[model samples]
Target: MRIAITRRGYITELDGVNKFIFNLAEGLNQLGCEVHIISHALGGSQVSNIASYAEKFFDFQGKFQIHALPFSYTNDALALPLWFLNGSRLINKLEVDAVIINGIVPLNSRKVKIAVNHGIFTGSFLNTNRITQHIYLQFAKHIYLYGIDLTVCVSSKLKEELGKLLNIKSIVIPLPLKLNLYRTEPLGKRSPLVLHVGGRSSKNAEISIQSMKILNEKYDLDVKLIIVGHKNAYLESLSAKYKYMVPKTLEFYFDASSLVVRDLMANAKALILPSRYEAFSYVVLEALASGLPVVVSSAIPSELVKDGFNGFRLLQYDPNLYAKRIKALLTDDDMWDGMSKNALKTARKYSHIKVAKLYLHAIQDIMRMKLNS
Candidate 1:
């Protein structure tokens, strides 16, 4: 079967969404589907110097073909419309059997469109304000999905949220992660440390920092927090005085080359994600594959975490509670080892090949339905 997937364009950098698309395309390709990735960008060598507006074809790792449209405009609004125009043209030209839209707002396809919803943003889409963006999203419930034949969500929570918008249910298909590259190994001992990734307001990193601070102050705990993609000014000052125990990482797209982050997960005792809300955590899955226990808030969905199984869920959003649980993992041997084994077992369901099979089944069903219709 021939398949086409569309997503937002980026050149040398990959956010979570881009990485998800790559994994999906690779998975589909492995299933004997001729997969095509349609994206929008302006950087690579153009069709010609005068034709900065034409599409360019390139091979991505000899796995899938990338059809990138030349989008030159810097204005956010203008770029999207141009992206929509060129993306439609490419998908239509390819004559694919089925097309998957990576997210609600990425691109449009003329083929049998299966709209994949990551999550509806109560926050900003691009540079737009909250009020206007809300209205746009509300309108998008109808306007943006006019041609969609089906809708899929990455999580049940996201499906429920988007169903409230579209007034129709969608299937749940969790996102894929490369599992082989994230192998687990026997650990002699783990460092008394925690990892907090992403700095977005939704990430609620401040609360994670607060938990770390409480541990450092009152509990006489000697644990460290590895802050990635964000830094608090006060924590920076404190860590400086304390000899750089707590460290922050620059926000960059590591693509499949997240060796440093993976190393941290291997050595660290636990991964911390105290977000108020999240669709699904890629890092939590990655950490679990590395046999790293997690400390998260009660707000995180329990499908990915259990209160006392692979990881503990904070019954309340208390910093002291989080700190206490983290300290237990760091200090105890039996509890940590048990949870680490459970974490690895839980990660099996989310492996790349398993997730790929789910995607293949869905795509095949959609193609069969389209043909019958």
Candidate 2:
């Protein structure tokens, strides 16, 4: 079957949502489906320019085609309607068997329409105010989704949350991990590198910095901390603000590519994420795929990080506790090796092609039901 996956943002950037789109497209392509990517820009930039930059990110030379609509916007809230107007025209012309939308957007097409729910931001408890939370939740539940044949949630928690908030039923489908693109390195060959992917407030990046400080000062471990994310002023200032506190070293990577991140994971001792909220974490899966043990907070879903099995899952954002766990993974070779093995095992279950098959099955079932009805 022919399929087209749509996203409002550029797919070249390996953010969580973009990763899901690329991985799913690759998965469907591997399963003998003709796949196409339909995307628009966030800023006021032409689609051709973005597509040129996007070419470097795709490893699959010409397995699928990319369609960038000539639409750009500054405000995401206003972009929805613009996308509905321009995106519908482009998608309708594509004439694919199915179209899977990465986020909420309006489209009036007769073909099978699948809307993916990555998560609803009710606001982060660590950063957002109550009023902001209310407005975000109201917009997500009432305004984001409409005229879609099926809604696919990335996690069970997300499905439950949306069901309760919007009184809508949705199916759960986890994010896909490109296993071939991310390969494992020997545990003994890795450096003492701890990775933190996102720099958002909800990511609890400050906690990771504090924990690194504790790991250096308290444990006297000579490990390096690498923080990678999109360009953000607050995240960029973190290294300078805590320079003295974290006496060892802190490497900040802004606008890093997926290949760069995968290489970092290949040689890192552990991946630390103290997020306050997550619908599902693709970074955690990438770490697991690279055979790197993760030390994430309890706020991350439990099934992803199996405490003492794949990695340690802390209950809170306490720096000392995180320091202790990081130290344990760095110093103890036996524990590290064991966790690394298990991490790879867990990653196999979320392989890109495997998850894509699941998506295809769901799409087929729903299409048949719609036809019958």
Best by lDDT: 2
lDDT of 2 by residue, 1-373 (tens): 9898988666655567876876787789779999888776544453445444554453443367777667654556677777778888877888888889886667767788888988776243325677866765565555345577788888888888789878778888888877887878887688888999987767888888888878877888888888988778778688678776454568888887778888999989999999878887888988999999999988667778889999999987798888899899888999999999999998888988889998899889878998899
lDDT of model number 1? 0.68
Question: Using alpha carbons, what is the TM-score of model 1?
Answer: 0.83
- Model 2: worst 10 consecutive residues (lDDT sum): 53-62
Per model, state how many residue pairs clash. 0, 0
Pull out the clashing pairs in model 1: none
**What is the C-alpha local distance difference test score of each model?**
0.68, 0.79
How far is 303's C-alpha from truth in model 1 (Å)? 0.9
> Local error of candidate 2 at 287, Å?
0.4
User: Runs in model 2 with CA error above 4 Å?
Assistant: 12-14, 42-46, 49-52, 55-62, 122-146, 244-248
